[model samples]
Target: MTKNNAQKKAARLHQAANRGTPFPSAMRAVDTRLPAAVPGTPWFRERKRRLVCYCCGHPNLIASFGDEREDTARFELYCENSGCDAREIAVIALSGNMIGTSSRADVRTLTHFPQSATSHRTVNGRYDDWLAGSEPWVRTQRGEDFPCLWCGEMDSRLSQNDVATDRSRFHLRCLNTSCVVREYAVLIVRDGTLGTADRPDVMAIQYIDTPPSSRRTPGDASYDFVAMQRVLDEDDKLARRRSTGPIDWSAATRIR
Candidate 1:
């Protein structure tokens, strides 16, 4: 979608999340004090080119952070797609001696936000278990059937078909009429010398047909490597720029 469309969708999603009139329980639990990204911040730049929504595959997302603690900080990322309920919370563990002394570059750890008693939406089991259950399947050989990641009941119904990457390929689709993710998810396999002589290292990249984030020239991979590389470059530059300065928590919420 265009930038204008993305902005409109973000407004709609925000309204939907904050609706407290008819369905109070439906309203999302968002912290008002969360720090929004400033114009030149790394988070702001990440929102522009990367961070695709897991549900609707939209690029319009909101990135925010909570107050930094002694050795950790929390980040909240949510899609702005009005129809999507995709959001993720990640905790970054800081390295070094002093509190808030380390920059983003100094942080090398990522973990899930601790679950609260009131929130049933957080992962139900161990973080590793949740990842194993939710992540898309990666295949190197044949005979393995790809399942529908979105359809809980009809998970194993979708059969493996071809959608080619380097050498091998596979396609998966949920036949369930009521399933939200009815689109075909293609797993592009990378073959040849990437792996051992017997098996090749296949990278399964999900390609949905409907969303703006999935729009690409025909035959292109799900990711735009060049664009992603540029984003990484920008992140490195931003990290370097912020390395010497102390984080101004009070100034974080201000948007220019």
Candidate 2:
């Protein structure tokens, strides 16, 4: 090809390469304040609002937090397009006690909070049992399928699921990971209180050493239990820092 043609082809290839690259993921900012509507009162209304999808930017869906209670609100937003199962969903449970709202009008104020960008680690399926049964802080029941509090992924139907106390919850798998063998803790914050044992809320991460005898992958043969332990241990430390307000080194380190 001629020099001019070669240059044009190179330019086209560069443009195509850039187009193929995926965009970075982002999280929405969470507001921890309750709305003005009382749970039992007639004035209390669960409103669903629509916004342009951050991924496709198509103004085709409505999303909002389910409702506001005494000092907490469970908010969920997802794509409305039936054809688009992009899984671009966010579920946020905010605490309102720390930040006071003057009235219901104030509660309407919304912000785009960012989620943690860190890539998730993998764990074993055996640990999944411990998470669902033993961990009280990270469990949520949905019909027969139990979803994890941290990532909201469901547990295996074959495995028996368990429940925890009102304060904490957990799930067997990390939806963000590929192996489907990771566990996550779901910590609920009450009234925006931080660091205090009474008000402290957190989600812990843990992994198992050996793969289940039922199934194993080529990658599983090389799994390192020690590394997994360190990761969980570090995650626990980071969870403590995140629950506290200071935003210390531990919190800053584990987060991507």
Candidate 3:
């Protein structure tokens, strides 16, 4: 098909997919290029305000905005790998009066766009050195090594060995051949008189890709810390329940 026809077909396929229709073949036929970066788009402005590289704290480009109100605002971010050509695209929304700040870190977490599926491979360039002195954390326990959270690979190494602040944690890259996913988690420690102890009570999972539409933006709604707390509390309960067994029920609920 002609390029213009393919673009139109892709747009239609996306609309169909959003409406719960199955159009995989049609979607695959059309090229899914990164939406043109516009200087004055709302999503671009929002990214300029809130989007930052989790590793280097560098700002990302506003890749695209939704043609409709409910569709997510898509963005592209560069990775910290100086030798890797991988970029991270995230989707975000406003929660309260704030446009980019959200109380629940994981509520609007990443939804990765496959690297192989994109038109361009990310260029390895050192624009920032956020994880300059960080250590790599790998999965080497007994039994089966947990899949690297970021790239879905079996060889994801931690970007930081020691986390100083609550937000200064590290991420793991996925090892799956075609998936360029990045996963982030935090290690919390309980404060006591003598010394603080590590607490597995809280764990946050951040995506290396775009966040879901429901979570990208902030609105005028009051910051519902209590509601957010409830979500976290339930998450903790679920984790505890799962830790008692070998089967991980959490992975089952991931959005496909």
> Relative to the true structure, how large is the alpha-carbon lDDT of every model?
0.29, 0.27, 0.30
lDDT of 2: 0.27
Which candidate number would show the highest TM-score if scored against the true structure?
A: 3
State the lDDT of candidate 2 residue by residue for 41-112, as single tens digits.
Answer: 111123334544322335543443322222222223445554332222322322222222212211211111
lDDT over C-alpha atoms for residue 46 of model 1: 32
Instruction: Give the winner by TM-score: 2 or 3.
Output: 3
Flag clash pairs in model 1. Answer: none
What is the lDDT, from 0 to 100, of the residue 218 in candidate 2?
A: 43
Model 1 RMSD in angstroms: 22.0
TM-scores, one per candidate? 0.22, 0.21, 0.24
Stronger candidate by lDDT (2 vs 3): 3
RMSD of 3: 20.1
Cα lDDT tens digits, model 3, 1-256, are 6757766676576767667433332343354653343223333233333333343334432233321222222222334445222233332321222222333333233221111111112222365232222221222222233333222235533334223322222333333455333333422111111111211121123311112222222342533334554343223321221122332214323332
lDDT minimum window of 10 residues, candidate 1:
201-210
